[model samples]
Target: MGLWDDLKMQYRMGGITQRLIFWNIGVFLVSLIFYEFRLGTFIFPDWLALSSDPLVLAIHPWTLLTYAFLHSGFLHLLFNMLVLNYAGMLFLTFFKEKQLVGLYILSAIFSGIIFCGAYFLMGRVSIIVGASAAIMAILVAATTYSPHMPIRLLLIGRVQLWHMTAVILIIDLMQLMIENTGGHISHLAGAFFGFTYIKLLQTGTDLSKIVTGTVDGVLRMFKPSQPKPFKKVHRNYNTQPRSTTASKTAVKDKKQQQIDEILDKISRSGYDSLTQQEKDFLFNAGK
Candidate 1:
């Protein structure tokens, strides 16, 4: 397969985390059209990027979550996606993809609100855009859930999950008074939200349900209603060979059984547990 076909196959086999990464990258590419070369920054419209002004936010509140899909630069997008992929996969190991999706969206809004509030208090007007906030939430959430989880790092040997999270948080804290203060504030806000999410989840209260429910509700609104089925009527199938029909049914059942087995393996041991052959089979089945 060509590169595009290869990527499409990969996307089909991968889970929600891979889809999320693709979305961020897709958004970044589209956003390049609005880049202001002269200013060395993207000049997104007020409705797109989160503004510190309360009035602006009131006019376009959706920017809170929308901003998280945007990035300031190529490196900014790259760094966030790398961390997101790592943390998101770790998160999926323990939580459902639905919860991860909700956490990402909710945390971005929480972080954006905090960032806007901070800037408003400082009497500064500015716009912020990046997935760092949501990415931080995923990373911190995973770490909170599995602080003792061992991770192997290049040239650093194995380290506890919390060690990595602490270093990142410390860097953000130290940079609070330095440059990109708004970005740092948002990152910290997202981290706090992540930690809080895990705590509430442990208490048997899942906050992610709110976002997921809202999303489902909105989707239902746009969903095309299915047509009611007519009354069943018996039809002669002797026109086609009985053996051909039986053979097709057997093939279909076999394919479905294989699919079910692969899915069960994924559920029990995570997607990474699948062998290359199984991955290829799943991808081809999807096609």
Candidate 2:
């Protein structure tokens, strides 16, 4: 296969957040290539980029959404992508694909709003760019989902998930007293949305639903669906499946045996001794 095809295949295998990282990186590279060709000015149109100018923003309100995908430098993109990768994987472990997508778009929009609002309040006339705010949102969401999960830091032994979250929040809070106070404020806003979103989800209410509905509406507008004809099915014979008491007892006995074996292993080696596969199996069995 050609190089482009190979890259596309690899991207297809990546998770939702990974796909987003690829898109952002692709945009950056394309911009660089255009710059080399002396066409960099067209990379991300000024109209599309977020601006603090009231006149420009009023003319193009969509900048709030587009700005989240534009990064200023390589290191900036790298940091954001790293955070996104880590948090997105954790989110995927519990959320369905649809929910993951919804969360991402909602997080991005919320982050954009925070960034723009902070910029205006800080009296800065510069445009806001980068995925940091959205990345922060994902990190906060993951922390909220499993606060007790273990996380190993370099040169710092394993720490509880909440501890890492506390450290991050503290750092962001501290940054508010520095030159990039606006960015820090945006991060805080994203983090708040993340935490609140997860809490609401647990209680069966998702704010992301509004974003999801909007996306569905747009998709349907582009690709209208046609109703399909339905056919009825008729069953020929009525027969009851037979149940054997001996077979039922045997099945129950086998399950009990498996449970006993797992309990014995846990008793002898401790829960941490079990592999992830084993732990998952035990968890599912208990469920």
Candidate number of the best TM-score? 1
Report the C-alpha lDDT of model 2 over 194-268, residue by residue, as the tens digit. Answer: 898899999999877787888888999999678897988988673544467568788989978986886677656
lDDT of 1 by residue, 1-287 (tens): 34575578657657889889999999888877766654565667778889999999999999998899998777878888998889998998899999999999999999999999999899999899999999899999999999999999899999999999999999999999988999999999999999999999999999999989998999999999999999998976688888999999999999999999998887687666877788778777887
Q: Could you tell me which 10 consecutive residues in candidate 2 have the lowest summed lDDT? A: 34-43
Clashing pairs in 1: none
Model 2 TM-score is 0.71
- Every candidate's CA RMSD: 3.3, 9.1
Model 2 lDDT, residue 279, Cα: 54
Off by over 4 Å in 2: 32-45, 224-287
